[model samples]
Target: MTKSAIRIALCVALVAAAAIVPAQAASGGAVAARSRSVILKHIAFHPRTAHIRVGGTVTWRWRDGSIVHNVVGSGFRSPTKAMGTYTLRFRARGTYNYVCTIHPGMTGKVIVG
Candidate 1:
């Protein structure tokens, strides 16, 4: 095959590989998650409580457009954003509570064990 054909094949192969791979959190954290995502929509956390093992990660994806939100927990906090992502890696075993300061009664927790 021509060099051009080989280059095209390589590009296609790369794209396919990327598609099959699980995406890491924005933090670029090394730990993978047992439970991958939490959706923020309609002013609430979809699961409300997330469970993961120690060294696992939890990613909060903001889907509520134009309405800003943030995750403020014991030792970590995310920037107040309307359209972005927040990732937390649980290093210890226990329950970590979080809330969106802008919205009262909007709360959740991460249970790591």
Candidate 2:
């Protein structure tokens, strides 16, 4: 075989091997939801309730709006930010509730089981 043909073959083989690596790596890991999120909009939390497995993380993201907000719960308190995010990982199984202190009616819940 010509030298250039051998080089081209090696390049093709390397590309094929690279493509299979990610698929193999993903398949080797356990398949389970490990995180969730809620969006804090104008006056409420979208999907005010979320369900996640124990050891999963919950992220609260602030949307673009005039009014600022926060999340207060059993042991989690996200600082008020205009357009920021807060994340917490639950280690136990239970119902966790949170609310925005600035707004009376804004509430959310996280159920871990």
Best by TM-score: 2
Cα lDDT tens digits for candidate 1, 1-113: 99999999999999987865655554445545465588889999978998987888899999998999999987788999999888878888899999999999999998987
Model 2 lDDT per residue over 81-105, tens place? 7788999989898999999998999
Candidate 2: worst-modelled 10 consecutive residues by lDDT: 24-33
Model 2: lDDT to the true structure = 0.87
Best by lDDT: 2
TM-score for each of the candidates: 0.69, 0.70
Can you tell me which runs of candidate 1 are displaced by over 4 Å? 1-33
Q: Clash number for model 2?
A: 0
Please give the clash total of every predicted structure, in order. Answer: 0, 0
Clashes of 1: 0
What TM-score, to 2 decimals, does candidate 2 have?
0.70
Candidate 1: clashing pairs of residues:
none
